[model samples]
Target: MKNKNLSYKFYVIMSLSIAAIPVVFIVLSYAMFFTHLGITSLFNIDNHFSGSVLTTYFYIVFFGILFGLMFIAAKYFKKIIHRINTMEQTVRKIAEDDAFPEKLAVIEESEDELNKLAASINTMIDRLRAKEMELSQMEDLKREYLKQLSHDINTPLNALNLELYLYSQNHNVSKEEVDVLYQKVDYISKLVNSISSEALFDIDNYYIFKEDISVHKSLKQTINKWSYLLNKNNIEYTIDVQKNLIWQANELWLDRLFENIISNIFKHSATNQIVITVGDTLIIKDYGVGFEIDRDHETTGLSVIKNICQKLNIQLDIESTNAGTAYRLSQE
Candidate 1:
């Protein structure tokens, strides 16, 4: 395909060379006629040469000029063709190797059409790279949202499953418990619908649902929701919170923060006792195998916790040792 395109330009130059033949013939015939009439003063000399020699010199000069022009044109076109092929090869390498490259070489000193073409190609490559980065970031954000959604909904579903199990075992489940389960179902529905919208695509627009709620109540509810899992793992927990402690916060986010902390404890902390204390601050500490603070360590749950703390204007401090890990949260 590349050779075919170059051949077309060669054909065009050949056609131009052929078209120059008649113009050359006309000039030669005029010169020969003038010499035949002894009107050779236009040649800038007296008639000291024969007509045949003068005719030969005219033919040589005109045809030589024609060939010289053709040679110059072909050389110029060859440079252009080489430049275009270089650009084509660069693009082909990127497509075939799927690798990133810096911008194409653009000769800023020249104000010709080829320089403009190179500039245009560089601009196109930059825009495409920017768009690719944007898409990649969006994909990462989407995955995070999905993981958060999974964690948020999973706790409530587990609570619901526990309720069903208790009922099956002939245990008396209260009416208020059923109402709370209904509210969780409704909250999950709203979250799912919101995540489906374009608002979730941007980080700035992620959390808009906020309300004034009792912090004690939200924390207690989270513990109760995770009661089944905690018992299954033989992990005991205690909550010490003031009954009337209230704070303005996103209710779901508050619940998620507590739930994620508790979930992380069960998953990572190899201990049996978990304690929570809530007042001006909320603290959850576990007697378990803690990690080194200086080391870089992160998990999905911890990342979600940090993000929520930042969003809700909460100050989060974590202390870890071989004995235990303590997470302290306070409004800032």
Candidate 2:
């Protein structure tokens, strides 16, 4: 894993070659003194002859050593240059999205800085991958919320329109029938307002209220508000909620949440007996044409159920079948 820089290696080699010049000159000087002044003087070689021969030998040795050193330096420099070129090409490949080399090429005794750079790059890539995953999850949550909102809002509005159209066609409609239609219209209006406020709360980070309230009272009031619609449709409903079950929640929001679900039953469910129980947990069960397990319900009630669960920090469970649909909301 050790990474070596080719440029640094080449610089060190060049410095060594330059320092060898003084050593080479000292070796030549010693050889000349021994051969001519010390030993060869005893054989009567004159200063002129000795000097001429010494100078000639010195020139020849200097030229041969210079050429040899130059050849060695050139060869080593060429190898360093080639390695640098290879590294440059590898960097370009990484930039173009090709994989980097697993390990940097380095001489056994050399120090390399490339290893540090590669490690840093790999760490950065890991962080980027984690951030990408987080963003993907948030995107998925957004899409699910939007889909639920659309279904919940549209179902009620469609039902209200049909009721209004039918009322308009009957010129001799009874006063009771007119009141029933008006109640249905009011339910639709409340549903639309609730959804709009929910969306605003999500975007602005501001919920409508914070109060210590009775959950039983909220449920009862919501049921009472929709009494006209239920009676008109001939739906048999019973409430078994205790009087003292209380919680910290927004009363208006809680009421709308219940209203949406009950209204949904009246619009889509084709049954008679509906039972709502309230205590530590709130449960709503309807003995109506139950929803199919494999089919998606078009009613906005389920969406409202999900919203309520999220807003209240409650655990909401739904169990539906051909027999009936049951909803349980519990504080956890």
Best candidate per lDDT, number?
Answer: 1
Compose the digit string of candidate 1's lDDT tens values, residues 246-288: 6678887787778788878888888899998887788899999
Q: lDDT of candidate 2?
A: 0.69
RMSD of each: 11.5, 12.8
Model 2 ranges with Cα > 4 A deviation: 1-208, 297-300
Clashing pairs in 2: 3-112, 152-300
Candidate 1 Cα errors over 4 Å, as ranges = 1-199, 242-244, 293-296
What's the TM-score of every candidate structure? 0.49, 0.45
Q: lDDT scores for all predictions? A: 0.75, 0.69
lDDT of 1: 0.75
Which residue pairs show collisions in model 1? none
Q: What is the C-alpha lDDT profile of model 2 across 132-210, one tens digit per residue? A: 6896787677667755776777677778777676866767676655665665566666666566545543444656575
